[model samples]
Target: MRLRNHEGTPVDPVPFLVVVGLTFMFVLSFGPLYGQALGAGLELSVGVSFALFLAVAFGSYYWQVWTARPETVGVVPASVRAVRLFYLMLVLAVLMIGLAIPLML
Candidate 1:
């Protein structure tokens, strides 16, 4: 389903979904993997990962909402910012996963 802002403008969900998915994966799997690589136990790793995920996800949401506010004016629109954040998150996630894989094996 499509999301709408306060102005009733349709917002693209792709970037949001991508960010969520990548961040989810980072929490559920990548965090633990990285923890293991660092010789940490599963429980501790997962806990830390979950906390980090929440922080990142909430921060992203906050940024999006803040940018979309009527008082906010910028050269870039909220949708464009969302897309840029998505790309940045995607690349970072991929790189982290890539780095984690070697440590895992």
Candidate 2:
């Protein structure tokens, strides 16, 4: 998707993820993976983890969109951009999860 800001600069499409993610999860069962994730703490940590997952997932999507192909990705080749966003989300997810370690401890 070609994302344009009010000023018309191409923008990273992370915010688009909420609609896409929810729609996807709605159609497909979030399943045991979701259960296992939420089973922890069941209170504070659950919320945190959910938020973290959204952050990471969005990172994956835009990253993928960016890196796929210029025709597919828009503005530029998508694979490289997509890969970058993926790694950005990965690193952020790791960092966020790492932050959670202290709470778990």
Candidate 3:
């Protein structure tokens, strides 16, 4: 089934799924380090991770809607922006995970 945005345009779920999945993996991998870095406990780290996941999910949805608007049609397609955003997030996640690993040792 297809998802519809605010404009009622059909949205491809792939990009959103990829982003959410990456975010989930990142949280699982980095949540503990996040807590350690901030001097927080397990509970606080889990809470923060949950909040971050929600924020990313909603933020991506809104970003898709904004990019898919008719006014931005001539500039860049929403699909392209979604792909670019996915790669950007992937790079950032890798960097953060890598940085966290050294700290874990």
* Highest-lDDT candidate: 3
Model 2 weakest 10-residue run by lDDT: 26-35
lDDT of candidate 1 over 1-105, digit per residue (tens): 766555665566555567777788767777787787789999999999999988887776555542354334476789998998799879896888686778747
Q: Candidate 3's error at 21, in angstroms?
A: 1.0
Estimate, for each residue in 1-105, the C-alpha lDDT of model 3 and write its tens digit.
Answer: 577777687777777778788788777667766776779988888888888888998888777643455454559778998998899979897888686777767
How would you encode candidate 2's per-residue C-alpha lDDT over 64-88 as one tens digit per residue? 4444333334565678788987997
Candidate 3, which ten residues in sequence have the lowest lDDT sum?
65-74
Tell me model 3's lDDT, rounded to 2 decimals: 0.75
Ranking by lDDT: 3, 1, 2
Clashing residue pairs for model 1? none
Count of backbone clashes, every candidate in sequence: 0, 11, 0
Please state the error at residue 26 of candidate 1 in Å: 2.6
Residue 104, model 1: lDDT of: 48
- Give the lDDT of residue 43 in candidate 3: 83
Q: Model 3, stretches more than 4 Å misplaced?
A: 65-97
